[model samples]
Target: MKQTIEQLADVELTENMLKIAKRELREDKCSREQSLEQMRNWVLKHEDLRNVRLDDQFLLRFLRCKKFSVPMAQQTLLKYLNVRRTFPHMSTQLDFLDQKLNDIISSGYIFASPNRDKHGRRVVVINAKGFNPKIYNSSDQARAHFLTYECLMEDQATQICGLVHVGDFSGVTTTHVTNWNPTEFARVFKWSEQSLPLRHKEIHLVNVPATLKWLIDFVKGRVSSKIRNRLTLYTQDKELAKHVDPACLPQELGGQMPLKAIVELWKAELLAKRETILNLDKIALLSDRGILRKSNYSSEKSSNGMNFVSQIESIEGSFRKLEFD
Candidate 1:
């Protein structure tokens, strides 16, 4: 039998947390049962969706992300499937044991802290310098990021409290900037803001070089105002500590444990959930069913919507400056 969310390890759904979930996400215990049933039934009834996970725990992540709105949850779920289908290269063969992915994890390119911030949000750290563009292409880096976030989202706490992103862009060079094209950047940003069922509470970019500062402004234009408002840039690690609790960060960022230790711990966590992560491919969308004939799934606006593709595409001319200059 599949484990209930509460039964899962590392889940601490306390009374106070439940109250916060209700207050913030409208996740009432009584009504959520019905919502879950509705979401499950909706997926089952949809002819385009196949091999979708019907478990309560799996469905609840979508429901909570959409504030328990069945229609919004359904739309996000479809986008979630469509994204994987659309970007088969980045989404497929997500085996943790694969040498390329394993190298990325071992290099500590991206990983979620095993600890949570004071607000109970998970802290996902991305070290841009760790990524060697020569060894691994943009897709490899994207796959590593995709795999890490997928593992983190399994915890109910993450779904309820949301995530705090701390990106360390120190040591970034021209190679890093040139590695990812504008379309790739736009697609990933749009998907994260619209399609992914993730509550991104805060984003902190530290040690940003003057050259890369333009990239920050570029990203702000792509995401929602809420996320943009929450986004912060820091010139130093100490400035970051003023906002995020030091205990929540790794020692490299002024936390207790060394970043290396934290990366090892995160690797173990991913290894433990290898099968679960690999099985994410099972949640498929049927192409012949005519559901995903649209030009771009990420471009399609949801009920609570914005046309991020157009927003991103409109700025493509400006984005292409990287190629020319």
Candidate 2:
């Protein structure tokens, strides 16, 4: 019982001594690290004498001299290195990213997820410890910007394959951007229809301006004179049209996106919408309205071919078996 009480007293005295030591460290006029700024200033203050650049050097020596934490050393490098002009090469970008990754891994931090552009190319922006990488909403926009940079800086050839957007391989649908203004969607749909190819007037006529849903009605169709008009007009917004290609916009839009590769696609959509109004007009025609009106043309071609087809088959069989025998 006496030993236990003595141990408790000793622990309390140790705690009090530690607190006094910490208070002295904080209040000491001769304190080595008075604040974060002071430590950083100490490292940066001696800019004249350096064998290696600040970014590439370790601040351990400087830290010991200034008596600062790791953050102070890091702040010195960050303040200086971040201001340098970026190199104009993908290879360099990749190398810088790899160095960042290695630094994090060495520090025992888990690598987060990395975003890949439509071209399957990844450009890592951040490498903080234990953080997952995220592809944000503006990922596509960032991708386009990257492509533009590659074009301007490297003068590199833009491969068509690289242009393939990663996430939305099938066009970016309305569901992708939920915060999209409904009125803007309607207005853009209206514009795409006018700029979209308007081929096969019979079918394209059904693409009305109301309920923008009808724009999708021309997903597949054959190219006609009108298809160009519809797609081109719909994509008439010059900037957007450049990306969508006004030469071959969907019929509902006004231009054919392309007849060679996308023709079958166009045909399928055309057949789908065939029954809307134009085909309805033809299918509902009354036979008596023309054939029974004593027309000379009707008298000459009087065969519904119900049993007439059977008679024709008999004649065809007679000719076939005679040759076989």
Candidate 3:
């Protein structure tokens, strides 16, 4: 930036670097990189994450970001060059790095993901450090013991391609095998070794929450409905409403977290904060759907309640005043 885009490779940033970047642009002479250096300097001076570490995540996010697509800032060009330099396979689709992150988290392991080269000069190296066994514990005690990432394995051999955050862990990664089979492990390894596509498909979208919800809705549709036939989806299970353990509840509600353990942790966090969560259950009845809507219901069953959309018309007062011939 101090010397313009052409100057960056040769000139290290001096105190005057920003002053040079901020100088008025000449017609077609200045580079986008200089503009980006200015932007970066601005963000560093103005953004919250200015002091944050520039680790893999930082660079991954930085190189793929773009606020616009025209007159292509040299920073964008640099980002493109960095992507090719860092993640060659990803350079073309740098715009959708979030989708790529989903695959890294959802799948238990990814193999042969180049992180460093043979000479170890970072031409590329395999990244399998993400396969920590504890991060994906499918047991209730383990999940709510810390309430990190909860993972459960099933018999079916389906592909899992997404990101899973296990919270901030200041501990070493570990691995374990239960009901272990070398053959199964080999198969798991094979799947992990497969070249993966971006975790999400692209459609013009805005807003992070909406984009995530879209992915969730898409996957939820693919989930076998047989597992969800009995209850309304996503509402907390009343049987364990007072208890937050996954082990005691049905499989769908994070069965990896055991009921007893989860309850204890919730109580601990609550007690630490001096908070109380109300229990709305009685001795004899399980929580029923829409039973709470009774107070809002019409006095004479006029069908004016909140769930009017799902209500059926009463046939008792049916009158055939024939609008039809």
Candidate 4:
């Protein structure tokens, strides 16, 4: 077993983790030599990507997402980098440090648990109880989400071990539900389905209000079956503990630490990395627009292998039923 960040904030990768990270270089079809060769070739061919640091860990994210298929990994990496270009508002910059954005984040809207689950997946809790639809719109919420996820991705353990989400709906009201933007929600669904590099193992929604049950159906239509199957809804907080470790949860959900303090730590870390994040966005913006070199790769290349396609189709075929549903 490898050690990751604990409750108090210091994170150090153990020798076992280092070994696992190194082993990935040779384990899949995107073997270190093959993948790096292709990535370096792709970068060399495009002037824009030349300056982009093709760090092994960074490249591995795309490779693992694509099951280590060289061509598939290449195409996904390029497309993933172009996310900022497609959605300018989702830029990874100092914008997240804005007062309003900070306010939303400070409210404990979303934060990751320092602890990992049995599978070693990091726990990401979305404190919907802290959400006030009146004060923050979809864009504000989206930025807050982007910041938290982006920062979380920086941790090697999170990228490899994956994530499980806990949506605490304890304080949700009609106002918040009404304010939920279906369009933005759909966009997020599509992004998670097609582009997000991490493996979202599961989603546990706790404290579901009777009135909010319909929201599940609304989401089912928009998200792929894969995600829908991972959805688990609970009417109360205790039911959530059956699925997630109590110690891994925030005090808001009967855990040790207060949610506010957890969010504060995450906010401080984000502020510290402001410059590095902004520079990454600047590079991506340049590459996305072909300012560096036009991505000659075609999107259709992603479909050649049935393994990846079937992985998605399998999700489409299955649907998990919630107790309320």
Candidate 5:
């Protein structure tokens, strides 16, 4: 059983997981090979996405996240690369061994739970207290987050089951809130919502300081209704556990395993995938030649510029009204 779970990324489909994938993601085993071929052909022909990874495992992540819709997967792939191009500081040349990043991981600021939730989603925790603004800037934090997400997405179980993010803001100070550039924050938020191939099942913010409420509201207003609906706020860990099982959480947040132990395990996982993460630097867009195809996806256009905040706010008001009504 353990070996089977370990081999899932090698396209070893489990009957039970296949059923879930079929029901939830429209993934049909009978047609999966055909679908993969179609996605591969489209990517190969895309003039803009140069040097994109073409392996079945890499392509399957986008396909599964888009529910096997080829066109959606294409758009997502483009957006993902575009994000890397736009935010070179955050995404490119991601070195896990860098002392600053290593220290951040060692502090256990952000990590995915080794255990899956009741609904089979991976639980990712972000303890704001672990961060020291004096030592590292927001870009370092973003890099750490990018590295963690890239590593986690390599898992087939994570790709299919999705992720639940828990933001532990217990010790978050006013300085932490002020450190972020609003435009950069909005752009990153937009990319997470639209570009990333991973499914976001839920986002729970716990022990949030009053200082961050405005920022939370800002995020709620900008994200899609699906994300907004999945967003939940908790005043205490007890309340958070009601939604995310305590068994999946680290000991610091009322779980069984020690936080240090979880961080150590996660560090080892990162080390194992060091080459895979480093290879991300090779994926580049053919933007200089102007051969990149423009996406009709709204977020694709919104991902650029200082005007994102105003643009989202203007659109979100009407979007929310239509969604709520």
Candidate 6:
């Protein structure tokens, strides 16, 4: 019943990992009912985790991300919710049905690839050429990006297999930079570096125009060192294709299908799940709580929730070491 190294490396939900999760994180092997109950009970015992959503599927992502180390996963989950609490403006309200937002999202600027990598990780492509700064500002476009990532996280397969991101900046210009908010951009990157439970298998930025060099440089310093190092910049499609399979890229970059059609498909898929996506803010953010009470460690004290990760790391070795690693 145990999975081999090949299965684990493939990112499958192996039997052995599930059993370990069941024991350490109180995950259920059969149904979510048991896990949900256990999470609720555990949350009730801790004041900080009270407002945090105890959804079985959501918690499982954190557990798997941390290799089912309960304490570390709990902290990651806390930081995840804390992001929503800290930045209510970005996290509290997301309207998928908004025509302008939908336009940006459905523009094929950002979408999941139809193909997977050798590790079964889903590829998320971002075509900067599709971006029209004249139509949407950086913040507005960021919301769409957030929603796209959020929707992808809903699928357990995507979480396990992880994600590879490709950003094509073939046609971006300095004029577009006129509309960017450096502060807001930092917050978005910080949120992903600290809160999001999804694994980042790879990051590729292709077709970088010279005008955007300073923009990229600015972003490099703003982001965490881990993210900065994980990023790979490419000036040509040939170099980009060397790292990412062209078969997994959009036609704009020598891939299978047209970017326009891919955008339309993404739009249709998002519209169908409009309600569910909107409701995520209700639980993810603290603004919905009516009165803003201070969490044990508020955003003012934590700053991008890095404190949670630090605290989690300090206690990580104390917990039973996971078998997989």
TM-score of each: 0.88, 0.16, 0.20, 0.76, 0.86, 0.73
In candidate 1, how many clashes are counted? Answer: 0
Q: Which ten residues in a row have the lowest lDDT in candidate 2?
A: 153-162
**Prediction RMSDs, each to the true structure:** 4.1, 34.0, 23.8, 8.1, 6.5, 11.0
Question: Each candidate's lDDT (Cα)?
Answer: 0.80, 0.27, 0.25, 0.65, 0.78, 0.65
Residue 62, model 3: lDDT of: 27
- Record all residue pairs in model 4 with backbone atoms less than 3 Å apart, i.e. clashing: 48-292
* Model 3 agreement with the true structure over 13-117: per-residue lDDT tens digits: 233323332342221234344434454554344322223222222221222222222223323323223322332232222121233332333332221111111
| Count of backbone collisions within predicted model 6 | 0
Strongest candidate by lDDT? 1
The C-alpha stretches of model 5 lying farther than 4 A from their native spots are 1-14, 288-325
lDDT of 5 by residue, 1-325 (tens): 1122225635644456667787998876555676788977887887777677877678878888998887778777877887888888988777889998999999999998887776777899999988998789989999999999999888787788889999998877655655566556777877766888989999999987665576588678668899999999998888887888887899877787899998988899899999998998888887634324464334344445435556655544333332110
Candidate 3, after superposition: displacement of residue 36 in Å?
A: 1.8
Q: Which of the two, 1 or 4, has more lDDT?
A: 1
Q: Compared with the true structure, what per-residue lDDT tens digits does model 1 show for residues 1-325?
A: 3445446424567556677788998877566878887987788788888899987768878998999998888888887877788787887778899999999999989998888776788899999877898889888988998898788777778888999999998877666666677667777766656767888999999998776677688677656799999999998998998888777788888778888989999999999989988888877888534333345655566344767566555655554454312
Show where candidate 6 strays beyond 4 Å: 1-38, 46-53, 284-325
Error of 2 at 47 (Å): 18
* Candidate 2 local lDDT, 1-325, one digit each (tens): 1122124335322344324323422312234334433544544554432322232113322232123344543443332222111211211132212344223333322111122233322211111212222322222222222222222111111110112111101222233333223333332333223221111111112212233223333322213345444432222333333443344333223334322233343223333433331221121211122112232321222145333224333334322322110
CA displacement after TM-score superposition, residue 46 of candidate 5 (Å): 1.9
What is candidate 2's CA lDDT for residue 139?
25
Checking candidate 6 for backbone clashes, the offending pairs are none
Alpha carbon lDDT at 234, candidate 5: 92
Task: List ranges where model 4 is wrong by over 4 Å.
Answer: 1-30, 47-51, 94-96, 285-325
| Tens-digit lDDT track of model 6 for 36-106 | 45556776676444445555556667766665555666666677777767765665556778776777777
